[model samples]
Target chain A: MDVQEAEQPVKKAALSKKESKLSTLTRELKKGKHYYILMAPYMIIFTMFTVVPVVVSFFLSFFSFNMLELPKFVGWENYARLFLSDDIFMISLKNTLLFAAITGPVSYIACFIFAWIINELTPKVRAFMTVIFYAPSISGNVFFIWLIIFSGDTYGYLNGFLMQTGFLLEPIQWLRDEQYVLWVVILVQLWLSLGTSFLAFIAGLQTIDRSLIEAGAMDGIKNRWQELWFITLPSMKPQLLFGAVLQITMAFAVADISMALAGFPSVNYAAHTVVTHLIDYGTIRFEMGYASAIATILFILMVSTNLLVQKLIRGVGT
Target chain B: MALFQHRRIIKKRLNRSIPVTIMLFAFLMLFGMFMAIPLVYAINNAFKPLDELFIFPPRFFVRNPTLENFFDLVAVMGDSWVPLSRYFANTIIITVFGTVGHIIFASMAAYPLAKYKFPGSRVIFSIVVLSLMFSPHVTAIPNYIVMSQLGWIDTHASLIIPAMAFPLGLFLMKQFMEQLPDAMLEAAKIDGASEYRIFWTIVMPNVKPAWLTLLILQFPVLWGTNGGDFVYSEELKTLNYALEQITLGGIARAGVGAAVALILMIVPITLFVISQSKVIQTMSTSGMKD
Candidate 1:
């Protein structure tokens, strides 16, 4: 033991030097040669599939380049036009932001409430209930659901029901009205994401230690809602942050819901999120440059919000 | 002693009928039915004949069911403007390959992010997570242009390859891997195992729950419908996509489209049910451990 202790200092010093050198050497190979080797396939595919298009789209969003014409650079003209003159684009952004801002918090609360119920049940009942609830996230064809709710025809189910119930004297033009179309969209969006967000919340709720709740109870936190507020919410921080991002992304992109329920960009563009607008100006119109600018704006917003969310997660992790 | 006996009886009663547990189950059952009723109605309608479908009230079941729609679906399958089978094949190829490929590739990539302390790993991980927040629709035009440039437009490659770059799988796998102990890797390394060997031997065996969760999440996202019926080309269509094309754009295709939707939903639902047990097992292990 005495000999081992005496040699430990010399051996540790030598080992540190050797370790540092070897790590540097491994780092160089991994980054310079091996790293690229590992990452090359994804990078190549993503570049081919994602990056190149983004670059090309930056060009397409400019100019009056329809599908037939060669894309001509129109500088900041498309964006300037959108702000200065495009009533539809302005309306789309406003509606999109409003929907996202409102829905994010609402869903956050709904998911928590849903999760609380699931986790409170017996394991067997919880699993059974979980599968039952999650079925919707995959079940309905988006178009089918939209058609059922907003068939636009007088005989449409919702329209027929409303008329029969005497709530409306005449069948309403459900999808066409710019005022009501947005609500139909909001309803569908909320309905569709119930499964994924609820599942995520359940996962979060399951992670919380029972002991903490017991501790809270012992500390005279006798109220059930108080126990939840002080104990349950803080424990589920990782999921809280994750669910926030999921909600933000879902609410912002709401493009397909718009397309399905109200057609592309929606009537008078009331429901066209910035994304649908990007697709219109860039893909259909071939204004690649302008699309890129819009995309970059979206990318910036998404990433910054995501980073802010990650910070919240890090605080919880620590 | 009398007080203690009384308390025991009360405790047993409370245990059997815990208010929290009752509330949770009731809430779950209510919402579960709410979410499931539409699909149930769709399936019930699929087997019903046309006369039974639009009853004055609503028929939960049909007295005389027929495979007439299935027969019609089959007979009129290719006879339709777009071939149903061709469309089904296209969607299947996209969904199956995309889900499987994502699982394989994401698992591979996640190994380094979760276990390796290599430089720039944090940056790479952050980028992947941040990408999750970006709406794919914004990239629709860019992706379309890129696909056109590659001559991949309307091909399954347009759907499959682009969707394969999904970051959700990687993030899920990374989070799952973090739960594994470093001691296992250290012990394996002490035994002279290479990093790859450690990952495969030790790490791979433990991540079954994460994989199932990812598979469940990704398949529908990638292969799900995009609100159009009929791709305008008979050759490039999918069964559901073809069904979607029903119209003078409205009431005529409602029943037929509902039939197709019922059939289309079966595959994912079956896959989910088959894997759900495995998912439960893995999750239970981790949940109980934690």
Candidate 2:
């Protein structure tokens, strides 16, 4: 009885503290209603389109939805089937990881290196070089031109050249052949991967303060290597991090190029990726639950890789 | 004196090595060729006579160039139910509205998050950054569901409205807006200006470069959109979607396909050329320092 009596006041005090905090929050909301108003249009739409959909997809992953019937709850079944029994899922996963492994780092480093080199030229030449480097990325569906270049017939550019040079006896079916499909997709992906990050790097290099470089020189920094390592890299951490995230996301989402170059469900599924697999299930099969499961796995893979890369980027020049 | 002379030689060599310059130039030329060949091939194919296009030992450059492909494109497009001009108009409308709407909404949201110390600003900004890592494909199925529910599936609103709040533009705008001085806002506040007034007069004008950067970045994405999975009506289709269909018409449409490809490629490339100078200019001043 004494303990109960003693706890009542403490509980009352805690309740009062909560009330005060709630009141302060209300006061803040009332004072800053304009900020909410300013952000309301975008926030409302963004929450509806992006945030809610992501949550819905996450929830849908645990069901047996076919979009025709009511979604039936089937906890862990979709995921189990994905991992244990689905052979194509395994293939898609392997292809996606391989694609990301090749294209992600290669394109990232290429973007920075080319941007760095181009930064050395005079402004007019730099502009020209930027266009040349950036043209392929902006050219819509221009990768389809590679189709003619790698055409299987003797008329094909690569085939004709190889045959004329006596490197091969017959023209090889590059896109149709399982051995060559993945490589060709990776090559084209790399070509197109220089879009945003390249521009960001160019901008980043251009923005480096000239005084800082001169100061570094006076402080005993010798050669361009030291300048790039200690000064330029450290200064452009934001752009680097930004570029890394974009590259990582793009690397994981390799559907469009793969689908375009190597026909969907390519021979032996050589060019099949997680995204293409998801598209097959989601759009073609209408297996919402399984597709969501695939999407969830991809989301986890991408976010985890991005987090790891972000950690590595933070340690740059330390 | 001899040691000093040796050091001078080394420094001069370090500053501008002839061999290194030659190596970099060589690399640039090789990479540039690799990047430019497909585009050059497409441009050349657009002008080639049909006979040349089908020739064995496929040539990189056209010996005989002509405008028959363009005329053929017009002819093929004329046979379609919807005129090619409608597709062009639809594309222009979508891209213009999408880009302009994205700029306005993104800047509006970005300004408050960047400048004001509101209670949820940090949380909102963090969400924006986190969303940057999410591929749109992951959300495509659910987004389709949401769009159907909103009755936006076949409408241009499906493309334009959702794109207006794209996290990338907001992220870029917020980052760019952070460079604006706070004192300017304070001065406007002291002069009896509303927040909207300040955002419109002071903030908008000051961030012209960021606006151009946003335009350049967003324009190509929307311009190249192939009606996505939303729009279905023939009249509502974009030029890119029409171009894809024509290309898929097989060997008969190859010449016209090349012509359509050139048309699609040229618009964005021209926009990039016109805006890239300003983008570079703005970005030069807006360096992201640690």
Candidate 3:
């Protein structure tokens, strides 16, 4: 009888603790009730489009569904098919990784370097240079000029130049040839790559305190590189990280240029990417389940890379 | 004044090495030409007559520039089932609504996320950051479903509403807003100002650069929207889609295609140029913290 009485008191004490926790939560909620109201509209839309879509994609990856019929349970069959039976998937995965590996770092470095150099110029020249550097990225649909340049006939600029200079016996099929298609696309991508990251770097450079550079000079920093390494780079870590994420996302999503320049399903899938593969199944073939699996894999790839890069960026200049 | 003079001297002395300077200039000029030549060529192509366009060993510059292509574009556009003006109106409607709506909602959402730590704040922010890593390509299939279920498909709302929720704008706006001094908000609160009043009058005014940055960023995106999967009606199509269709009209329309490209790019480019300084100023504050 004494043991039962003691246990009852302990249970009552635990219940009171739970009640307090619930009360505190409600109190906090009440305190920030206005914040919740402010956030509601954006949160609702964000939830519907961005958050819900991602969650749905993740869930749908496990089922087989076309638009017309009910989704059927498929277990891991779609994923297994992607890894095991699908040769095109392997090709796409390889191409996407290769494309991202090349474009991501190259474009990122190029953005920073151009911004850094442009910052050294006088303001009038700086603005002019900024406009010049930023022009191609904003120039919509003009990358088709690259198509004209790399055209197979001698009339194409590249072919005409090479032939005129006697560097080639015949005009090369730049976009059609498997060996050259990826490289051509890569070149064009680099040209168009100095985009948001470039602007961000410029802004980052501008935001750096002039006093810091003076302080570094006082501390006996020898040259521009030292100034950049010790003072400038560390000050703009946030911008650098921001640029990295943008570049990584863009690098992985290289479908538009490839589709336009190299032709979709380029010469034997030479320039095929994960997104292109996704579009193939998702939009054209209506293999929603398979496409969802592709998307989920891509999502995992991008997020993991971003996380890894974020860690590396945090270690910068330490 | 003396300190400023001394700083200038120090900067001059610590200037980049001569060899590095030369190398950098060379690279700058090289890339500058590479970037500018295509655009210059496109501009030239737009003014080229038909004969010049098809000339062998394609001419870098048009021997004779004319407004023929522009005239042709007008004529061709007149033949379309939907008027070119309708496409323009559609684009204007979409771009204005999408960009403005994004700035307002994102700023509203960003205020609380930036300044206060309420329930689910960290979780909500983490989700926003996570959304940034992946491209929208992943979300297309599911977003289409969501749009249709909401009865938003085939409507301008499909494009405008989703655009309002673009995570990067919120991410950047929040980052910028965090830099706003808490003391200012606290003082406002002490004055008995409501949180809504604080957000609208004080916070919004102080964060002009951030919203301007959002405007510049979102403007180009919305301006260049092709209304990919969500929009399908001919009347509902954007200007970019219309121009793209014109360009796809085959070999005979090559001159018109170049003209179309020029027209397609001109508006956003002009917007960037006009707002370049303000946008950069805003972007200066657009840094994310760890």
Can you write out model 2's per-residue Cα lDDT over B1-290, one digit (the tens) per residue? Answer: 22112254355324445576668878887998899888888889899989988887777899989999999977866677898878888989999999998899988998898887868888998888888897999898898899999999889999998888888888878878887999999999999999899989999998888888888778888888899889999899998988888778887888888888898888888888888877776555433333
Worst window of 10 by summed lDDT in candidate 1 chain A: A32-41
Best by TM-score: 3
- Shift in Å, residue A171, candidate 1: 2.1
Clashes of each: 20, 0, 0
lDDT to native, each model: 0.67, 0.86, 0.88
Q: Report the lDDT of model 1 for residue B182.
A: 90
Candidate 2 lands at a TM-score of 0.94
Chain A TM-score for each of the predictions? 0.79, 0.94, 0.94
Residue pairs with backbone atoms closer than 3 Å in model 3 (clashes)? none
The residue pairs found clashing in candidate 2 are none
Cα-lDDT of candidate 2: 0.86
Off by over 4 Å in 3: A1-17, B1-15
lDDT of 1 by residue, A4-50 (tens): 99999999999999999899978766654543454555556665655
Best by DockQ: 3
| Candidate 1 lDDT score at position B146 | 61
